[model samples]
Target: MKIFNRVAAAIAAVACLSVGGAIAQSQAPLVVGSTLSLTGPLSATAMTHKLVGEIYVDQLNARGGLLGRKVEWLVKDDQSKPDLARTLYEQLITSDKVDLLIGPYGTGTILSAMGVAQRYNKVIVNHTLGIPSLSKYEMAFPSWSLGSDPGNTVPNTVFDAVAASPKPPKTVAIVTSKFPSIHFMSLGAREVAKKRGLQEVLFLEWDFGNRDFGPIAARIKDAKPDMIWVGDIALEGNMLLDAMKKIDYVPPIHFHTYPAPGPMSKSPDGNLALSMSIFEEHAPFTNNKVATDFIQIYHERTTKANMPDIAVEVQAAASYAAWQILEAGVRGANSFDDKAIAAWIRKNRVNTIYGQVRFDGPGNFGDDMMKVKQVQNGKWQMVWPTQFAAPGAKLQVR
Candidate 1:
């Protein structure tokens, strides 16, 4: 990675702030920008991402800042719409002239931002997206496993665990939201179920915004699957669960890609749920000092801001990891230049709280760091990728 001394000359001279001061506009502050789903359907996940980026930037500033320049994160609400996200991103790159870019949540929003990023030749550090279509772009860096893992393996980890269980499920049902990433995950899970010799009793997909899942749940119940596999957002997952409970349809195992930790904990019978997540409060796979400090800081920040206590979810960690990677890349390249940072990321392996991180040429990280966990008696228990499982972490079949 070649280091360039271009940070000081990149932007106009701007004001800098003290530790507790406002992040006001500045000519020299390294501008990092994005459009977030702050007030729309994806707000549940995007809100956490917003806070994670804020905390990461604050921590960086406290540690002398990025390349000796303060960071100004320019985030706008996209209302969870692709068109709005695209417009905001174009504004960020052209009018706002952000020095660096971070992507918004979901495959749709991130895909909306990709064209703007490529048109401007800006490096977009993606956090919540794993769309297969985004692989062809050189400037996109996906922080999660969906991009790099073969056949979308991150979403298949739970199925792998089911296959390995002593009393493996004999029948499986797959249901998913109509979104691109969730659809892809469901497809992968279906293949894994077949390969494991589990009978595919039912396979169904629904529109993303459909609120009524009772009919779907009734269908699932009729199938009498030994296990139910779901791929969808947290909100939709909760909707489906409620529908399942409406008819008392509780399969032996209910595994999901969306880690609906909050709702799952509050459900009448939460323990039966299982999901793959990176945000478990004390997940062993990400128990390094950085991760520990992140948790502590996140708590302190939320408390200080008078916000509700929210557990660190995958969205927060993945969003924070993207910032960490950006910081590492910028410092390594010694330049705010997009091309330089992208090249550095390609040439060097960055260490993050997630693990020793190295991306494939297409900016996808290894899925080996992902963990499969199940809820038991209102607590999360690591149950897959046994090599990284925490003490006492094991699969329990009811």
Candidate 2:
């Protein structure tokens, strides 16, 4: 009887130990890390990404987190520098020991992070990587769903929309920032414009962070093309528009690549400004329950934070979709193993805020669902592809 009691006590002790181990494991926080241009040239746009991430993380925790464990996001500021981004990613892996990785804002920073992820064999989900040809990393996925060749696909999409307009511009002036992705897409736009038989009257380039837009704006005015493709990102586009306004000039049909959403919409000259978009806070785009809830929360949070643009546009949508992809990958893998998550993402399609995105395309890119948007009534509205346009919104050209 004494020996049997001792054996039963030992069995109970083992059971308690197993229960404690499981509890401790379930309580552990799953850390995900990334860098953003929290300061520097890309900060304005990157702030949108930051906000989206925070919203997603909050909502994630509310939903019991991933795999029944809490999630902690460790974000470092890369100051819009690609080199700094590379170093930060390394530190995130070795020192911070994050379980998952998300890429930064710009193409340069994303590419930089890509290298470190490759070295560590970590699955990286990125947004805003424009030049897909440069994205050869198999395990790396882009949330900027501009197809395999954004340089070609995005430009063609924009051109297709404009061509359908009542008075299509016969001449186009291309002014571009030498930022990696912007420059690549601008070059492709130039080729596409010429191939489509539109005359290129002016082709100008400025260094990535060039604040002096007066000269460039003056040159665009001189070219006097019927349309202008302004490949400026963040506040660069705003600065150019301000310069053009000083010269009392507004190109008849000016298109921006990645403008500061808020400033651009508020700028009086920004009305009728055209740009590309994946998702906007409008019908068709917001039909899904996930997107509907996201837009509502985004509105509430950004308004509270007093952000520049409270509207959900391409940039914000892309960032939100990236988190969705990561979450889907985690859930699909159902494991903390990085390789398994990557493999699951590669083999399956994940429904994102941007729609159903699959990574089977070239460079693991999804379909190019790029749409054109115009500033209307102090808000950005989808104007092209009739189906996705806001109620009664159509391409409005000057």
Candidate 3:
């Protein structure tokens, strides 16, 4: 009986120490602050951004932390409101007094926080803001296949893919939103279609928040377009796909500029949708140790937490890549000073899971910013710009 009691006490002590260790890590003093839409329409995306940020923080902590101090991450909910995002940035800068700042998840939120960032002289590494308009600001650094590049390249990529097919598509139709970014993408697609000598069988621009895609999809099917392109984000893409399914209008080729999480992620009938975006599973790492290690770590951590999907999110890859950029700057400069880190980043080629990148003066990748990926046989493959494609990655149009 005494031996049994001793064993129980020893087990209790071990459990207590494990819990205490986690608490101590959570209480670390080096705070990194950012705003996110944690409780609104964009909450799912925000969760992914937060998960990747936490993963990087955990990895850094495991390495004995940055500059001899543990990192604490503070993310305040912006509720997907631009006004709230501005207010949150003000609070993060003045009240929270975060040692570093990273850009939030959307173009509007990042744009709203710019004034605060400028006033406080904070250097922000943009994780998700893709609007080309935002590229003018020197303080915000965009990471991902860039929101701007897709508007131009998505159409060209789709055309190139179809043109290469055994049965080339000669007619194209486009359904897009009037939202500036998406609209611009539609115009770019139109231009690419013209350049490729494909007849414009149908073209429609729906107002923002116009939810019914049935009418548009029906018209596109009636037109019998050889290829169809949808220039909206993920939610609209899913709606369009569902509408198309109801009408039994599956085009030989379909493309989306935003690469939303639905229809394009995985389909039971062998994923056929093509999208232009940065994906973790398909990113061009080229045997780089830093990127491969980051990918492996992300998978291991997310799997252990029972949230493996987060590791596959494009935002997750980009958010962690932002941390990698900042981490390199912090360690290279050996200081937490934002200005010094920014200066170091401007001059140095930071290695990240995304690839080696050196920011142009305006915080955009000077070259090779985005890729064309297709979901073939339930796996995402980089199928464009042959130089950056993964091994065994090939394009197949069904």
What lDDT score belongs to each candidate, Candidate 1 first?
0.76, 0.92, 0.73
**Alpha carbon RMSD to native, model 1:** 7.9
Q: Per-residue CA lDDT of candidate 3, range 1-398, in tens?
A: 99999999999999999999987865557888898877765565676677778878998999988888888889999997788999999999888889888888866788777768888888888776655655665655666645346555667766776676667888888889765566777898898788879899999988755779899878988999887888776357767777888887777888776644433565543266777655546435535666666677767776776652533545666788888888888899898888888778777887666666777634455444566667766666667666655577766666
Per-residue lDDT over 1-398 for candidate 2, one digit per residue giving the tens place of the 0 to 100 score: 99999999999999999999999977999999999999999999999999999999999999999988889999999999999999999999999999999989999999999999999999999989989989888889989988987888888888888998877989999999999899999999999998999999999999999999999989989998989999999999899988999999977898999998988998898989999999888898878898889889999998998997888989999999899999999899998788999899999998888788899988998788898999998899998888889988988877
The numbered model that scores best in TM-score is 2
- Model 3 has an lDDT value of 0.73
TM-score of 1: 0.88
TM-scores for every predicted model: 0.88, 0.95, 0.83
List candidate 2 segments past 4 Å from native: 1-22
- Model 3: what TM-score? 0.83
**Candidate 3 clashes between residue pairs 3 or more apart in a chain or in different chains:** 234-260
Whole-structure CA lDDT of model 2: 0.92
RMSD (Cα, Å) for all candidates, in order, is 7.9, 2.3, 8.8
